[model samples]
Target chain A: MTTSPNSYADKAAEVAARATPERLVVRVRALSDRAIAWLFIAPTIVLLLAINIFPLFWAIYLSFTNFRANRPNAEVKHVGLDNYTRVLNDPDIWVSMQTTAHFVFWTILLQTLIGFALAYLIDRKFRGHAFWTTLILIPMMLSPAVVGNFWRFLYEPQIGLFAYAVSFLTGIPTSEIQMLGSVNLAPWAIIIVDTWMWTPYVMLICLAGLRSIPDYIYEAAEVDRASNWRQFWSITVPMALPFIMLAVLFRGIENFKMFDMVNLLTGGGPGSTTEVASITLKRDAFEAWATGRSSAFAIVLFVAVFGLANIYVKALNRVKQR
Target chain B: MADVTLKGMTKSFGKGGAKRAVDGIDLHIADGEFVVLLGPTGAGKTTTLRLIAGIETPDAGTVSIGGRPMAGLAPASRDVAFVFQQYSLYPHLTVYENLAFPLRSPARRMDAATIDARVREVAKMVRIDHKLESRSTRLSGGEMQRVAIGRALVRRPSIYLMDEPLSSLDAKLRGELRLELKRIQKDLGATLLYVTHDQIEAMTMADRIGILAEGRLVQIGTPREIYADPANLHVAARLGQPHINLLPAGLLPGVEMPPGTKTIGARTEHIAIAREEGGNARIDWIEHLGDQNHLHIKLGEQKLVTLADPDMAVAPGDPISLSLKNPLYFGRDGQRLV
Candidate 1:
């Protein structure tokens, strides 16, 4: 038999043609991974836009309009910078802002400090550590509304257990003291309730951080001639700082937007003295039907939280990079 | 520097003390001597090192450094530095900061300028001076190990304890670092106690090697003495590459002795193999190593390996003669008979 040169070339070209399509298909399959990844991420992006971005832009728009909820048919006339100026100059708004700052600063401070201390104590793995941790976490797990209502009863003047116990312990009269009614005591009451509710959350985060450290580190530090206090400062604190900062960021944001506990416990109480921004915004929009002004207030609160949270996220990223 | 001594040292774990992790180990290292504790896993080498480092208090023994009792003195007070196998450099700190940590430690109490100078000096000694500004996470395995050593060395502690510091590196790096470690220990004249299961490391780097087995000190000697005259069959087996071959041998009634072949112990390289030609038996297999070939020859009922030249051609199932040259005879209980 004789083989033609042209026929062999034709066969080789036919083989190449056959392999090219399959190779192209493989190439297309490999390229589709990026598309699949984008497809998986798209839903989260859409949800974030719907929940956070859309409401933010809408609030900003409403803040510049005179669209009061009581007058629905009234024209949404543009009032450039007027509501912002009013909110900035308003004495009541400033008071609520001060109250918010006070709550956020004190609550975060106390929560972080107490939570870290408790975490360090529990990390020692003594007897009944798990039991004690679970007990501490009960306050964090309780519904804020229920806790507020329960605390209100406990703070009752004569009949409540807390008041009676305090009076019994200190030998002071419990008949006239009103925890949620007095302006001086109401902020402290809110701060106390907030710290009680969130300290356990911080403790849990710090505990995870502490437990993630290997025992060899302490052994090495011991071998390095590091004292107990030195190890705690250099090794333990630096290692747990990221988790502690995370707790602070979470508690700070939550306290800044704190409404449920304040609403349930004091209802922004006695003569606007305990009215936080959230309570004031609620009164403006729902009680007085001033949606435009409330939207402006809401926008301001959103900016404050967003800016602070962004800074905190940057700090967290820095820690993780380290 | 302190001469560390452990007398009747025993440590046990578990609630009822039923489990003995380290059982009755007695060891002493002279000041500025580099000693290596060699053992397999679960052999209590690390426990022994930790005991000497004061990380763990012995239940039965008293540990002393420089003739002072170390019963209640904390690890820091004992003036010992430990380098862990994991290289426990602070991940958040730079190489310089990690090296400076031990120097600035309150227990050490060096001033700021002194700490900086010592850190830089140790960093240079470890050949990681350029990496001083670099974060530890960015460092390679060898670099990290060097930094760990630098951290331990910066304080000039009385005793240096290293727990498998080179175990994580590759074979070539381990060999290179072993030499470096020996040179550094010799140059600094620091009392070093190193722990590793790698016999080669113990053999090459240790001034005096201590062999441990099952939480017990099996043997301790210089590398030459340990290799030449092992106290037991286990030490004989553990000290060699392919391990010393154990074969039952009976003394022939009036065999003439060969002069200058009276070394105690079976050296595999001394055994010879040739075609049987009406002699011992046959070759079972041939394992061709790169430089030399090992001929597994069956003599009577026992098989013994004989080193052959790489150029020598030998195949399996071939008839072969075996001759044991200067074989150390052991009795039924695995003890060498004179």
Candidate 2:
């Protein structure tokens, strides 16, 4: 019953011992809202810096130098803007740029047209629509590497199904029409495979857009004495324009950096006929071991994609506003 | 403008649950008449409107416009225009484009100048001409509805079908547009088959109102006729603001009613109320609504309402005498007895 410091200290020691360190910490302390949030997100921030931001800054720094990864003992000279100028002035890089532009334009056009047509057909709620929709989406689900390998085999001149079918239809020999070997046909082959794989992706987005249009709008159109074609152009297209544009933007960004399918099918062979920008960057960085030059090429590509996407996004916003 | 006739039209939707949305109902709306289909929610008024517009095919019966059967005809071929309840304005188009959409359709290819001229005329008719260049989302609800009406009117089809066009507006806006719509219908002299759940709209706009209950048209008459005499207890109960007082004829021991009558109906305005000491009812409350007063009165374990003139002074707990004028009588089946 005596109130003494010794007794009080003993009581405090007893209480502290009864609550173990884990229990004490859990029950006695509370972090502030911001501290808790930061604690939860710290790992993500650290990982993002290590994997994404650090490499970006590193590449920007490396683009200004003449450092080759293969030649370690060579002096890392600070050649200001030399890599940028060299990459820009090189005619080979322009060829790749042209290839990329051609690929992006054709692939987008084919995918959008075919994709929107498929979407319109599926929107009819025809017999077995759900089953057909799932089946049509199979192409988009296959891995690009697998698709490329199979398509390359199909393009084989002698024993391939595609060449034989063409030969059978046109009365030409299968050996004479080589899809992968010929320079002119190699580009078409890659474009065809890309359109085949990605058209379903575009169609999926368009299907969602088409489905989202309310039934009442069409009914109103009907009551207004509009023909079916008129309704299609006036109501359906305008309503689904935003979603279609969104799909285009996504496909454009993806196809601009396209590498795997073309690489697997042609390996940028047939005398550099189908070498896209990403393919050239890959060859320079990993094969030639010219890290600084490859980094500059990659920067140019990144800026191009970023700028084009920004422009497309502005158009998308305007469509949505309308 | 043309007459719209529906002969025993019926539509039943059985997808999730079997419900007859519109039973066999016959109606003949004459040329240049504004007829409103009045009912509660889910009473198949909209379905009937859709059937008349050829948007829905009747399971049994046929709709004829201008003496021609609408069987196997598309909505476009039926020569009708429809306005929806939600003001389904095309959100992506300007008001001018929305008004011009119907006119510029390939079927109705009036050249650009004529289309533009008609758009201007209808826009002015709806009083939305000034806001024609604005995007639909930027306009207010009333303006959107006006544009919707303008869209329906641009082509001047043979008949007009409107589905609860004023239900989305606020009360004040609905009143203003209701008046505007009445004026437009008169000026155009166009046949319109309008549908609404609001009785005030039915009373104010329709030259004749048709009452629907459980997918059947029970009665059709002028507004004054429907007001003075509803077809049955259901129509009587649905048509008034405070609601018609429906009483069992045999329950009121002192009130005199026709023999063999099972139900009695009286609107608030038709009921006679007087302040008396020896009274049969006690006032529970008085609600002042500007120029009108609503009296909540208790009568023999039943609560009834009576509308009082604003000048009438009364309060809760006051004794009052209640009488019925032109009391409605119904047999046990709820059909009106003349």
Candidate 3:
């Protein structure tokens, strides 16, 4: 049988001519734009509500009750403010808080100074600078677990490169330098490892800030007869302050809840000398299985970080505005 | 104030030093004079300013400020204030602090009261005193440039070097700032070397205009001398509105013939035209510029544009006789033939 080429379109046209406006409206194939947009986005919203928002509210609810993960079949009671008061009054928690504060303070201070210095040197565009930059970034590129394990090996008193080097420098025995084993040096040992692993990240951010400055400003400063020292304080430091602050913000939040590296390296070692807040939270939640009290402690931490970060961000904005 | 001098200064850039950014150039600017180097982009106008400011080390020769040879001297020690093409103000500082920065150098060791006084004086001069406390990044383009110029003015250096400081502003603001800069220069009697490609800027503000091309100094003179008696075809093309027109040596009918004359340069003053039935040139178009009109005429295959009054009896396609009256002549080598 022979078929005409326009037969299909002709039949469709005949159906369209016979249809009424109401029938045409009923035959519409696609939903409105708003409905289509929601259709595409619904899965992501539902998943986020289930995984993120639900857990957050659930944790808040658990913080007010006496619930134990190990004793789930036992009676659960809504013991209002009891878990919060017990966590707050615990002396062990206070010790962990002080250790965390010390670690954060020293690590931030050392990383900023060393990172800025390295960034300044790299900004000079010296020979082999690209090679050096890549070499310096190797530590930051590795997984934190790898870095922690590696540094832990280096901290060993026997047959370790770091202990031997320190011994050689100070003319002392390698066995005397027990970094992770001794109470006095355990906190410092963690600080040193964290600085080594993360200083490159801070340097990268500062390098970006340095490169963003146009060359003409320096030329202008030179023509204005500004001394090199003056230019460093007046032009270089002030211009890079905002980026430095941003790096601090990121590192601050990350280190507040820092866990993997510290756990692998020291594990709150040498009689709780290096136990940070996150280690305390992990012990309470997983080891002792105190779900309700641990959840209360986690809420307190979240508020502290959120509150401090908000204040820091406001200061950063003020600096940028200048 | 000091007399600035460049003795056979030369500079080159690129790998293996192949591209000559500034060729051998000898120039002198007497004390309290305003000299402008006019050239198109890549003509080495900015390089010359940088060389004088000691920002770039020349491959040969020397730059002298106040008869002191400046070789191996740092830019900061050279004592020449430079205004960059872009307003390179310190973004983290207020306008007042930016102006006070040059005074705060350890070498200067200026007292706080004196620094404050100078900053306020310059802020008022540039007409940006109202926004002294605002950050330099917060101002508009023109206001930023004003602050930059004011920063340079706060220092009393040997000479001032500006690299197209007004080129970034709009036409209206450029005109206003040009007048203000000239007035400020005259008032201070500062020895200044300003570089730009704008002919109007050079003509109106320069005590002497230097024409540069292909990294070479082609000619240097007062605006009128450069216009009336250009040394070469390049210098003649550097100045004047509607530009000097070039025609075949015998294309027009008014000048006495000189031997080896390959081309004739004609401005509006040299060209004379009259309406005739069978004239040599035909009016191609008339561009009305309000105060004056640009009359584009066709002489066989060659086209020339000249300024004309708006009320002139001419229109597109009108036949008119065109001839030269004491027009400039150039040899085959592009050198001027007197």
What DockQ, between 0 and 1, does each candidate earn? 0.61, 0.61, 0.69
For every model in order, the TM-score on chain A comes to: 0.86, 0.89, 0.89
Error at B145, model 3, angstroms: 1.1
Model 2, span B232-304: residue lDDT tens: 8887887878888888886666766666788888777668889999898889988999989888988888888
The lDDT, on a scale of 0 to 1, for candidate 1 is 0.84
RMSD of each: 5.4, 6.7, 6.1
Sorted by TM-score, highest first, which candidate order results?
3, 2, 1
TM-score of 1: 0.88
Off by over 4 Å in 3: A1-44, B253-255
Greater DockQ among 2 and 3 belongs to: 3
Best of the two (1, 3) by TM-score:
3
How would the docking of model 3 be graded?
medium
TM-scores for the candidates: 0.88, 0.92, 0.94
lDDT tens digits, residues B178-218, model 3? 99999999999999999999999999999999999988999
Task: Sort by DockQ, best first.
Answer: 3, 1, 2
